[model samples]
Each structure stands twice: as structure tokens, then as C-alpha cells.
Target: MLLELAGIDKQVGADTWLYPLNLTLQESAVTILLGATRAGKTSLMRIMAGLDTPTTGRVLVDGQDVTGVPVRRRNIAMVYQQFINYPSMTVADNIASPLRLSGQRDVLPRVREIARTLHIEEFLDRLPAELSGGQQQRVALARALAKDAPLMLLDEPLVNLDYKLREDLREELGDMFSQGRSTVVYATTEPAEALLLGGYTAVLDRGELLQYGPTIDVFQRPNSMRVARAFSDPPMNFIEARADGAALHCQGMGPVPLSGSNLPSGAVTLGLRAADLSLQHQGGDCLISGQVQLAEISGSATYVHAQTPVGNLIAQVPGVSHHQLGDAITLHFSSRQAYVFGPDESLLRAPQMEARHGSY
Candidate 1:
């Protein structure tokens, strides 16, 4: 492991903000930390970078305990969400500031090389105030890269850029990490960002580590509804449910067939992602009736929002869709696509669900 945290905890003003958390970031791979605002993602990154002292537990890098080390001595580079630059200095000076502070004499050539890599070589003589927001961000990244640190901590580095610029920067950053083989701990509130930079993903809720594992595994098999909902764009659709003697009963989905016999009876939550829901010509097994409330078409696909007895649900259909607003549609799902959660909001991996459904 390149970076590791065990039993980590943090608090502020007598209130326990973050609970015990553990994470292992592999060398040469990117670990994206994902959560909503105020989930303590930044705090965790700060602790790992030695910027903030942990209230308890330990922080280890390459099997070395550096928990109490100061930020300057940790040898980690951080790219913050905001653009922190010397407004009065040129881009070249900003990138070389760290090397000069460390008393390194031969730094200009290295700074130039990093600038070229980040595609900012031409703007080296321009002051930060004269550059665009994206350019300034690239300069910050170049400075971090020039440091040649073993670990890189990026806190929402692409949040401030426009859509196209953010995409381009994401690709560039991915390439940089691949070339350097540097361990990275990235913090982002976007699910797409986490999936784009595929690696270990840790979901945080109220400072607690909810689930951490391979990105695909966590997205496909979320531990709970909360974790599952976190990965969706508009979020997952939830509906009340009950387990019949041998069927799972939902208000709109009807009684879905169960493959096992030991299902707990009572109220449950049914979760279905927008991508998992489909429109069908007729009602069949696991079919739900709903009226289209809105339709959004974007290039090759269309998103249909429907109003059903259970609640509002969104479905993504490939290519152009024929459905229109106020049209009654039949929504279908394979037993495999349905995720059932207990009343306590914990995931219920019923044997019947797994045994019957293979795609979910």
C-alpha cells in the first residue's frame, strides 16, 4: 500500500465529526474519495497529506508511520479545489516556488519540463491573474507535479472548470498519473468522476466510511440503498415493498417472483437505477404502470421521467424514444435489476435475490 489509514477519527467543538475510518491506497493507482458536501472527504485528505492532525488512529505511507509529521516534511503534493497562486508572480515562478523554498538550485529546467507536460509551457511568463481559471488550475497542477512527490492529494481539482475543460483535464490528469505511477487520493462529489478514474472508491456519509472497494464492484453491487443512490445522477428510485409468502410485492412492480423461500415479511425499500428501468410495449413480469411526466432528449439517448403511484421515476432509453409527456407507459425490470433493502435502510442480500437475478 502506498498510503494507509487505520481507526482514524476527527472532531470539532466537542462534536464527533468523523468516526473511525480505514483506507488503503495502492501505489501507481488512483483512489477517488466520494461523498456529499461536508462529508469530511477534505479532512481525510488533509490528514493523509499531514496538513491536519488526526484526533486518533494512525496514518501510514509505505509502511512508515508519519502521523505526527508536519505538512512540509511529509513529501506529499496537494492540488486544492481553489486556485492558490502568487498573483504578482509569473507562472514559471509559481511552479518553481516549492523547489526554491527547499533550497534546490537547479529547478528552472525541471519546471519547464513539467509546464510542457501540463500544456502550459507557452504561458510560463504570464502572471496568474492574467490567465484563465483553467490555466491557473493547470499551473497549480504543474507545481505539484514538479515537486515529484510520492503521493498526490487532489481535492475537487476539476470542480471549477467548464464541462469541456473539466473532461479534458480529467483525461490529462489520468495520463499524468499513469506516466508517473504516483499514488493519488482524489476527492470528488461527482459519481461520474469516480467512475471515470476507475480504482478503489470509498463512499463517505457523515464522516463515516460506508463502503470501499473496486469502483465497478461498489457501483454494481452497492452495500445499501444509500450507497447505491450515491452513485446515480438524479439518484435511484425508491418504492415501498412487502414480501409475500413467495413473492416480493411492490406497489407498481407488483408481486415479483422469488427464487428462495426464506424472505422476511414486512415493509422494505425497492431501489432501481434509471439505467435499469426500461419501457415495454405491454405489462409483464416486474412491470409497473406510470405516466410520463417529462422527457429529456440528449443526442443519442432520452431520459423519461414518469409519475407512478409509488413515486416519480426516471428511465433512460437508448437512442430516440417515442414516448412523450402525459403518455402512459409500462416500465419493466428484470428481477436482477431490483435491489431490496430492509426497514433499517441496510441492504438485504436475500438468497432469493441473488439466486434468481444474475445481472444486478
Candidate 2:
């Protein structure tokens, strides 16, 4: 099922919902719509599912234009952020509805199979309202899988779940998607979710399509500061710098030699992810001293906000590290691991692959 959006743009009255953009989804693979709230992910997904027609351009499926075609006429299935289910029907019946509608001879077996995979088999006889939020979402997913539609669209299905529930379901869904043949389009605002899904990703910002490629490729080598900022969690740190003949002169940090790339001598922005900064000094690392502004612990990681001579920066460290407000701290980072952005905010240099460690 090859899905293509050619010059797709949407507008409502005076405000624009989506800028004109083109995208071609790889058939039978998951393509994550990665962005923040109102990044045009849902609007774009609605257009793909035939729920809304683009003000301009066309929607193509397998080279055939399906623009303005009602969603009911297309072989598509969608799961939204909310847990949508038939209140009057049991979980078993909910999963079986699509199978029964498609005239499948073995509806019960198919329903049981999907229910078991989603861990909702135990709640098969119960109504959606009777189950917990996470359980109900599982039932919704089971129903979508049961449809066996060539195109499956999920708009942040796990967004409403608790943290632990979301973590568990994300892993389960990754495994499930790997085994399925459906062309999946899963939308999420979290970079970790996109990385966990480990497929193609399309990054969107303010209704504009910024970059599209393999999940890891886009993450490591963001074409612009906008993509980097959107893909980061605590947000990537930025420091103003100037490119000299063969090095970059960063404020407070001094000169850091450049290599393996050609960047014109002018003003540039240096980007470093919070995860890349370390508290301990390492060989060949540039050190910057600052006073701790705030320290927070979240899920086995400590985030330290510091006010440095150049700018404010955040460093993410492993485990529950203690730091007091107004405490002086020195952060270390390899210049080779930093990203250099030219005047226009385009990427001039990205860290070498080996320098980047661990997953998002």
C-alpha cells in the first residue's frame, strides 16, 4: 500500500493548518509522524485517512489519486488518542465487529487471537467502560488489528496511558508492528517513542515538514536547529559561536578546532544534546563552568540546569545525582560530539557516529 501526499496543504479561513508539503510512505513499514502538539501531525494524518481533504494537492494510494474520497470508501483503519469502543458491545464482540462485517468464517478465533496478543483476552467478556484506561486502549488496538486493513493509522494511541503503561505498550507495539504486514503510521510527540518504534520518521514543526528519513538518521543528523529542538526531550543546548579559519571560537569555552568538514568563516550556532554533556571530565573534552540553577530527578536520570558564562544549559546524568542550587558545576563535552549550524540554521557539521552513545 504505497501512500503519497503530493503538494498537500490545508487551510481554514485565514489561518493555515499545513504548509504545502509532499511525502511518500514506504509500503508495509511503520512511518512515525514525529512532532509536538499542533505540529500538523493530526491534520496530516486526517488527510491521509480521507477524514479531511487538503485545500490543495492530492492523496495517492499505490499511484492512484484518492483525494476527496470519503474514509468509509477506503480500506483504512484508525485508532485515536482516546479509547473508542462500542459501549454496548463486549470486548470480544468489539474485536469481532470488523471480522463479522468482512464476512470472515472464523470470527471468534480471529478475535481471540488479537485479544490475546494485546493482553486483553482476560477482559474479552467485559465492556470497555468496565476495564481500566490502559485495558480499554488495548481493546481498541485489538479491534484495529482485527480489521486487517492494509493501512493502519494510530494517532498517539498510548498518549493517554500512565507512564508505566505507556512504556509497556510501546515495547509490545514495536514487537507487534515488526511482525505485521500492514503499512503503519503512528503519530507521537516524544522522541523516545519514535526511537523505540525504530522505523522511518517524518519530523514536523509548525505545520511544515522539516525532515524525513530513517529514525536514527534523522535523530543523529538533524538538517536544521528546528528539527533538533523538536526531536530532543529536555531540549538540545545551543551556544553562539563564530567560525574562524580552522576552528570555532565559542564564547567562554574558547577555540575548538574543526575537522573533516568545510564550514565558511562566519557566525554559527553550536548544539549539544543534554545527554551528551557529562559531569566528569574526559580526555579531549571541552569544559565549561557554571552554577547549578535547579536539579531534578526523573526515572533514574538527573537533569541539572546550570547558568553558564555563555548561556543556560541542561545536562542529563544517569541515576539520582544530588546537586544544590547555587552550587558550582563543570560540564564536559567533546567538541567532536557537537553540532555546528551555519547562519541560516542549516547543519554544517554533525557528530561522528561513534561519538554518539546509547539510545534516546
Candidate 3:
């Protein structure tokens, strides 16, 4: 739909809700608003949906200014974290509401199709009150899809669903969006969800728009440390280091070779993804010795938290690895895997795209 927000910002009394920012959404594609709570994602989505007017700037759709347009006047659909539905209406009726409102003659066919896609067809005859939370949310989603709006906004629609249901719906929604023509704006705080959706992302922190680009590009090459932290799941690890004479030195850690690089001699922050650190050493990997503080197993992987001389670090190790508390452990990673951030907290150098992405 080619939605654009130019110089947009929001304020309430003496407090600011969103800092000044500009964004232009890619037409007919998903644009994820990726951020944590109070990161201005919901505020920005409300502005886009015409539910809230920006304190400053304009909301443009297809070259037309929609700054003061009310949501009811716009042909867009929205699904929120809470599943909203008519208490008296059956699931089928709820799904058909939009189609019937649009004067479509074959409401049943369209409703059934959407219900089937969302795996809610079995609950077609049930009322919202009679269905499970996950099932009710699917009905809400199905209704929005039936509206066939040019733009669709979902504000953490699956955030309230159970883990398995959320996982299932996320994949389903991704496939559905791919086949549809709607310009979708999905908001979530999950990096996994953003990665699974594989769309362009706009990373927000507090009230500021941090970075916006292709999801993979932004994930692999964060422009700054804040963006990196926002995109990482367990949070990217940072080590204080000094760059000097073709080498980087960390306190209590041996100097690592910084071959053929021109990183100005000064204090810098080295970032390492949790997945990059491993207990098993590979050739040319720098060793990091530490004592295990906690070992937590989640699904098929174990998250090992350790206290090292440099700092407290967490390593995401694959499979079920057994480790006791207070056990001395050594984690290893190639120096090339590190992300070098300047003293100003801006990314100075990122690992090669081929190596960083392909390693996993």
C-alpha cells in the first residue's frame, strides 16, 4: 500500500512517547515493528491505523496524506493482542461478518477458506466464549483476513497464545501473508518471530526508531550496539577490549590476532553472539576460561551462564550438555566471529556475512 510516516513523533503533556522519526513501508510486503515493551511499537502502529494522530508530522498512504483520517474511514484491518469478537456470534458468523459487510454474495466459501487456513474450521459453530483462547484468536485473525484490506496491522497478535499454538500460528501467518496482497505490519518483541517471518524490520528502542532494513541485513549487521541488543534473543555478549598493534587485548585474556585491520588504537566493545561461543574448541579459536554459574536446558539446547575474568557471559550450546554449577569451563570462538564496536557504541566492524550467517 506504500505507507509512509514523515517526521512523526508523539508527546503527552511533558512526556515524549515517540521521538521524531521517518519510515516508508515496502509495498505489498510485511514490515515488522521489532522492539521490546514501551519501545513505541504500539504507539507507531496506532498512528498508522489512524487511531492516534501523531503530535507532529504526516501519515501518507499511496502519496495521499492521511494525517487526520479516522480509522473507520480507511480501508485497513487490524488484529490486536486481545481477541475481539461478538459474544453472541458463532465462529463462522464472526468470520463472515467482514465478507457480508462488503456485500460479498459467497460469504460461506470465503469464511470457510480463511477458517481452514487458520485451522479454526472445526470450531465454526462455536461461540467465542465457548472456544479456547488460541481458537478465539484464530477467529479474529480469520475475520481480518476476510476483510481483504489493502493494509493489515497486527500488534503482537500471538503474544497471548500458548507456546505451541503461537509457534504454529506464526508459521501459518507467514505463509498466509506471503500468498496475500496485503501490506502487513506485524509488531512483536521476539527476535525469533521476526526471524521466522523473514520480512523487513524497523527496530525501536524506548521511543526512538533505531534501525530499519531487511531483517537479515539488520540481524547480521547491526548498525549500533542498541540495535544488536534489541535483535538478539539472549542478548549479545560484550567484552571491554583495547585495540593495539594488530591485536585486541582483553583483561585476563590473551591478545587475539587482528590481522590486516585498521581499528584505531583505543577502547572498544567486542560483541559475541551466545551461539558463537562453544565448549568444543575449533582450530584458530580463542579460548575463554570461566566458571559455570548456571546451566539451563531449554528444548533442544542448553544456555550456560558463566562468570569470566572479562565479564559474565552466556553461551547457547546445542543439545543437552550437562554442566554443574561452579564447574570450570572453557568457551572458544574465532576472533573473526567477534563484532567490533567503537567507543561511541557504533558498530565499527561486523563479521563477514558469509561466515556470520552460515556458521549457524
Candidate 4:
């Protein structure tokens, strides 16, 4: 299925819900809608699934316009953030609902197969109300998968699940969606989820399509500050500075040189990822000394929040370590790894800059 959103824009009364935008979804491909809260991801997906019509523009499926088509007329199945299941129905019956509606007599095997994939087979006989939040969500997913529609739309389906279950399901679903001739459009607020899915991504902000490209490419080479913020976990570190020839004159800090930069000398914003900035007492042009404000340890990484001369910044370090609050620390990173954004938040690096030096 070739899905094309041409000049699509949505409005509610006098308010704008989504700005005019165009996008093409390849056949059997997964396109992730990455954004922050209320960024219009849901509205965009609903438009694609034919649940809502764009106030202006066309929806083309395989080159045929389906703009005015209703949800019931489209061959798409959707799973939402909130659990949507027949509360009175058992998990088995819930998974089998779509199959039974289509007159499939052998529904038991299909129901059980999907249940096992989602690791909810043991609770197949329990009603939705009897299962935990995660289990009910699995049942909902199973039902949607049972439909096997050509177009699958998932709107942050795992957002309501517990952290562990979300991790487990994300991996499982990533594997499940990799195959099959289904064109998938998944909407989510988490950047990690989009990276885990490993597909093309469309970054959205304030109803605008900020950037669209391969997931890794967009993640590493965010087109602007908006896209960078939307695709970062623990958020991105920013430094207010002015371009000085091939370097930046950071406010309250010294000038830092960025070789091979093509930016014009002017006010700019320097963006660096928390993980990109190394936590160490090292000397470098990109070094910033600060005192620890908070250190959050997650088994695999430690997120240290510190106040530096530039501003409050966070650094994600490998492994857990004991760093007393108010302990002095220095954050260092290579100048090439930083992003140079113009006063308007538009990226100012040469086209080859990201390809040559950008890292996650």
C-alpha cells in the first residue's frame, strides 16, 4: 500500500490542529511519528487511518484519493494509547472478535497464536477487567493484529504500560512488524521507542512536520532545534553562543573552535546531547565545569544534572557511580559532535558536517 498525505491540514473551528504537510509512506514500511505531548501525532494518524478528514488536503492510497472516506470504509486497524477492548469479553474472544466478524470459523488457533506472541496466552480466558493494564493492552493489540489489515495504525499503544512491559512489548512488536506486507504508522512521544522500532521517522512539533527521513539519520542529523528536542531523551543540552569565524563565542564562557564549520559569524545556539558530553575532569575546548545538582542512576546509565557557566545541563554517563550532590564535575565533548543552530534555531552546519562527525 502506497500512502500519500498531500497538503493535509486540519483545523477545529478557528483553531489549527495541524499545519499543511505532505508525506509518502512506502509499501510494507514502518513510519514513526515522533513528537512531544499534543504535537498533533494523533491527529495526523487519525487522518491517515480515515478516522478524521483533513480540513484541507488529500489522502492518497496507491495514487487514488481517499480524502473523504470514512474510517469504516478503510482497510486499516488501529490500537490506541488507552485500552480499547470489550470489557465483558474474555481475552480469547477479544482477540477473536475481528476474525469472527469476518466469518472465520477457525478463530481459536489465530487467537492463541497472537496471544502467545504478546505473552498473554495464560490470561486468554480472563475478561479485560480481570487482567492488569498491560495484559488488557496486549489483548487489544492481539485483536488489531488478528485483523491483519494492510494498513496498521498504532497511536502510542504502549504508553500506558509499565516500563518493563513496554520494553518487552516494544522489542516484540519491532520484530513482529519487521516482516509482513503491512504499512505501519506508529505514533509515540518517546524518542527511544522510535529508535527501537528502527524505521523511518517523521518528527512533529506544534502541528508542524519539522523533519522526515530515516530514523537514525533524523536522530543524528536533526534539521532544526525543534526536531532535535522532539527526538531527544532526557532532552538536549544547549549553550547560548555567537559564531566567531569557524568557532563559537559562548556567553559567560570562552570561544570554542569548530573546525570545518561553514556557519556565518553571528548569534547561534549550540546543541549537544547528554550522552555526547562526557563527564570527566579533562581539558578541552568543549569543557564546562559545574557542580552536580542531581544524579539519577538507572542500572545501565547515570544521568547527572549539573549547573555550569553556560547553563543547567545533563550528562548521561555509562554505569552507576556515586557522585555526592554539589560535587564538582566537568563535562567535555568534541566540538565536531556539537550542533550549530542559527538564531532562528535552524541548523547552520555544512551538509557534510553531520555525515563526518555527528554521533548519538
The C-alpha RMSD in Å for every predicted model, in order, reads 4.1, 1.6, 1.7, 2.7
TM-score for candidate 2:
0.96
Worst 10 residues of 4 by lDDT: 350-359
lDDT of 1 by residue, 1-360 (tens): 378898889988788778988878767788888889988899899899888888999998888899999997877789998978888989999999988987899888999988886678999999998898888998988888777677888999888777776776677777776664678888999887777777778988778889988776777777887787776765778888897655688765567766555468888877887767888643444777889999888656688999998889888777898766799988887665667788988877522232111122
After TM-score superposition, the amount by which residue 304's alpha carbon in candidate 4 deviates from its true location, in angstroms, is 1.3
How does candidate 3 score on lDDT?
0.90
Q: Once all C-alphas are superposed, what RMSD does model 4 give against the true structure?
A: 2.7
TM-score against truth, every candidate: 0.85, 0.96, 0.96, 0.92
| Candidate 4 Cα lDDT to native | 0.86
Candidate 3, RMSD to the unseen true structure: 1.7
Error of 3 at 247 (Å): 2.6
- Error in Å for residue 69 of model 2: 1.1
* lDDT (tens digit, per residue) of candidate 3 on 192-301: 88888877999999999999999888898999999999998789999999988677899988887866678999999989999889999798889999999999998777
Higher lDDT: candidate 2 or 4? 2
CA lDDT for candidate 1: 0.80
lDDT at 23 for candidate 4?
Answer: 94
